[model samples]
Target chain A: MTEADHETVRSGLETHLPRLWRYGLSLSRNPSVAEELVQATCLRALERQSQFRTGTNLRAWLFTILSSIWKNQLRAEKVRTGGGFADPETELVFDGAASMETNNLLRRVLSEVSELPEAQRQAVILVYVEEFTYREAAHILEVPIGTIMSRLSAARGKLAGLDSSATNARKTRADEVGKN
Target chain B: MVSAGMADHPRDEDLVAYLDGELALADRQALDQALSDSADLRARLEVLRGGDRPFRESFDLLLDAAPLERMRAALPDPTISASVISTTQTPPIPANDWRSLGIAAMLLLAIGIGFAVGFGTRSDMGDTALLAELDALEAELEEAEAAADAAPVATVKGWRQAVADYQVLFTTDSLTPDQGGDGALALASSQVGLNLDPATRAAAGLEFRRAQVLAFNSKPLVQLAYLGDDGVPVAFCIIASNKPEAGTQYEQRNGLGIVHWIIGGYGLMVIGDLPEERLNSIARDLRKSIQL
Candidate 1:
């Protein structure tokens, strides 16, 4: 590959390192594995930059690669354990110092999010936390937009029970009314 | 208390999509009209919106907490394909081998280090490193073929590396369970003079597939093929050796975890795409079963 090609893809993927790690941590729930995912994803993006479409969202492309890598590891872990899947929850929790859940609400939200089944958690994080449009999140996850929407609604069905942020919503609405 | 229009009745998916602004324009406008017309609808939408947990700000904490420096240090230098590995990938070798085995030992160490450094800094987390190693490994195949000819003169590590290379070729479909492996295991076990009881075959917690007598350096090397429950391939091999007796040693080789040791003039190994600790435990179980 040309050096210019290397610099373009390398820098683009590098800029998203922390974000990729965050995504990886969400998937694997392990910090070391997240770092491994980032390094592997960078090498892969550089090696296969040819496949990346120019002018498309590079961050989405990189997240897709990171997601692919994480899924493959889970598959390998599946094979390694024979038929049973290893529980990521018990082994390496990403929630230790890496989590800054300072308030009760944030901590509860995180706990509720983390408690979702693997697939729903992924959909929620990509669409909500990372703000991938449902379309882009679907592409990264290789699921249809309908599936993403259903996963999110399913997540919202559970999370919407959190004591409403009604006070904040009311204040914002009052301010809007006053401005109008 | 006005009845909601059937055309505008929103499902939970619509409420979430509305929150995300992901609906098409016409659909969004319909939801907007429905919301403005009904206080109950607006209140329902507000609760869903309230469910937002500052997701971006919260995850950014995780992002900031990433060990960026360490991870950055580990990122491959895009300039050189093999530089980081050449300097960093050192196989675990005992320190005193230079004293006893001399240049032959050193030659073995050099070869181990040479190839290990070529692509071995760390095991491939998945296919990225696997694809790269596949290319590097083909280049080494000829060297392994040459070693096959000189097998009598080959050291344990040299031939084991060859065996490890052969392992990279396995897929989930590489072998089937119980394809005349009993016969081969019987014959090869007899040839190698080890009593691998049927119980020993199952000791590794894997499904037995087949066994074969493979020649290395013109010496018969017995290979026992097996698969895990999910079709993860694993192999237990025995090759005759004249090396001094050694305790079980565990390591990762060419992306596979291997636990090997010398006993009764044979080098025995349990190799698989498993973690080192796993292979080590399997080896321990086999050793215990056999010694009994």
Candidate 2:
């Protein structure tokens, strides 16, 4: 890349770092990994500056690069080693009497969303958190629009279930408090 | 697939698309009518949108999370590049002029003196040097004692420095196979007692990425990169220890969290941009899975 090109890429990377990190966190579910993904994405963007069309969307381009790296690494990992399955539905289920009167319900809901299955979590994060259009999310994730829709649907249903359970828990707690 | 209960109603995917405004004009009109006619559909739609509020809120933390200063620092300096380009574009400098040479020498001497003074006295030239050094030494000793109390171990500050250096190397082309030669699992096995097995790493919710031999503080360490389920990068580092003792320590440097422990004669470190608690949990899992 030319000297001016390097400067341009540097400015672009800085501007997008925070959003890329958020996307990374949403996709990977780990802060460290999110940081790495952002770093890698920055490096890739600089390395392949020629490939980046000037008139196109830089944010979407970066997200696509980040998603590609994550998926490639994930695929390589799956090939070398397979992990034991942890049941997300069981792990994230709320107890009937657990408190739902959290001051930061948004954070609570987000945490619950993070605990979702990886595909569903990414779908929800891109659609709801980042406010990406379905087509944009589908393009970034390298999945069909139908897949994105299905993932979002499943994610929505899961969240609704969790919310109702939490609501019921709050009610049960109130009822017991009233009885005593 | 539509659920048995929702057989007569529209599919959940259709409802989600309607909520997202992804439906076409005609489809949106039909869904709007369905929503107006059916209370059940509206209630379900509201529940589905409930997550949208909190889901968006969770992401605010990511924005508020500290900026990636280290990554930015690793980028190429445009000022230096601009200077390089300018020099190449310009004619060669004339044979060094004595006047300019003399001025450059004086500037160098002044900067050298400034650095020496800064290092030696830290701008403090009082008789309290002994007390300051003593205080610093005492603090260091106290920290050592506390670490000893928690677990019998010698401090390996090199591991932390290595992690810092690795973070720098990771962003550059030097990190690619052409430069550092990506050391395989077999190579890693020869350096230390541990294996970069996926099954072992998976116990800690990490997936192995690559392993390489990197030098830090004049010592070669086997550094294995892993991706946690959420895509956080975790480094599993091992170096030969002078003291074959088993103890664990936690430290945070340059916004990255490190959990280093000794097992057998090998010093192992788990480093990442994670919290201390999270690092400890991964370390605990590693300790269990690695079998020393």
Candidate 3:
């Protein structure tokens, strides 16, 4: 059963790779670096798989691994390589069959989120985007829930600007279309 | 139509939490009523709302862009992955004893010396200046690590971190309501040999709940607990120490903001479920008003 549980964890890593890559992208702002982060996080997870509490939140635990590595060592190494401060929102944004003109509001909001200070961005992604409760985000981020609350509050103050503009843009579009 | 519970506008943080459906039911009802009555509050909420759907969608698009095939193929082989972890991972050696702390400091110094020599030999004779610079830098880091581990303020245990860990368990109900000018404060003060005075503290949204005597290494540790007006638990922890006076230093532990300093032969800390900025402001206020 213990062996089976460990297998469950390894297979489990597959299900979370996309989300992990996304989180890594959010942290590093570079898709390749984010992939590197995901790779390292997975390797670290497997190496210490025994320490995992079997039935608890695997996603949160995986996130804890990814963030700690970014905080402890990967960030310093990235800074030395000039990869630390690189802003690659263009690479990060969706570029599928959907036209860029159609994704204007979505892209603008995402760019605003990406441009927030690291702590606030992390809080915004974890709590608001990933839907982690403030408590869970606090635990994952190794901060008090109050810190998470304040980060979101500050983030809201910034994102609210984008929200209002987007709302007004919608209203203007509706006006042009003769909608009530 | 505003109820008395709507005494003031709920902060943007509360509104965001409410928007996420994460606000405690304790606060939800009051906020719900306030929204129903005040269009101004509703407008504020609207400005903060709508990010959830957009965020999820954008992120999903980002996820769709993920190189899923490449990532999966790149995962390390499970059969031999255990040995892949870095060797730098060190088990935490508890620095509970001065004798042990001394050893850690000496070992770090030896490592520093070894590092300097290893790198010094690699540099050419003309680069002697570079070697000296490297040695000096390593020595400084060694000294700092040694001092941090040996600091007398929290000699036997990570007392500040311990306090933070315990504090996370606090709730509004965890601390029974008390104005804190009572026998409890007096007892704590007597044990700690410092005034556990809430009288001097200006109540700025944090109401004093209780004072209690907690001990570490047989030294009296005073915990003065408060509940934020919005129901977060905040605490001030003090213990007798012979360390020289130091200015406020901020740190985070157990997900709480902490600001600590040494004053009047005592180590003082203010920690809470608060942002670092808020905690710092309160710490600054305490530094001025709470006379040693």
Give the candidate order by descending TM-score: 1, 3, 2
- TM-score, each model? 0.50, 0.47, 0.49
lDDT of 1 at A10: 66
Among residues 3 or more apart in sequence or in different chains, the pairs in candidate 2 whose N, CA or C atoms overlap within 3 Å are: A28-B230, A28-B231, A29-B230, A33-B231, A33-B232, A33-B233
lDDT of candidate 1 over A16-101, digit per residue (tens): 78888888767755554555567667655754666676667889999998888667543355335322222434322234532454
Best by TM-score: 1
Please give the RMSD to the true structure for each candidate, in Å. 15.5, 19.2, 19.4
Candidate 3's C-alpha runs over 4 A off are A87-91, A94-102, A162-180, B1-7, B37-39, B50-53, B82-292
Q: Please state the CAPRI-style docking class of candidate 2.
A: incorrect
Give every candidate's TM-score on chain A.
0.74, 0.71, 0.80
- Candidate scoring better on TM-score of 2 and 3: 3
- Which candidate do you rate higher for lDDT, 2 or 3? 3
User: Which residue runs does candidate 2 get wrong by more than 4 Å?
Assistant: A1-8, A74-103, A162-180, B1-9, B79-292
Q: Per-residue CA lDDT of candidate 1, range B1-292, in tens?
A: 0113322556556778888888777777887887889897788788777666766655555666777765564454443321111111122333222111121112212111111111112323443444454445444544654565575453455667767766756655436323443255666667567776552365646777766555454455667777764777787888788998899888878798889999878888988998887777777777776642
Which is superior by TM-score, 1 or 3?
1
How many angstroms is residue B277 displaced in model 3 relative to the true structure, after the best TM-score fit? Answer: 59
Query: Which clashing pairs does model 1 show?
Result: B151-B217
DockQ result, candidate 2: 0.19
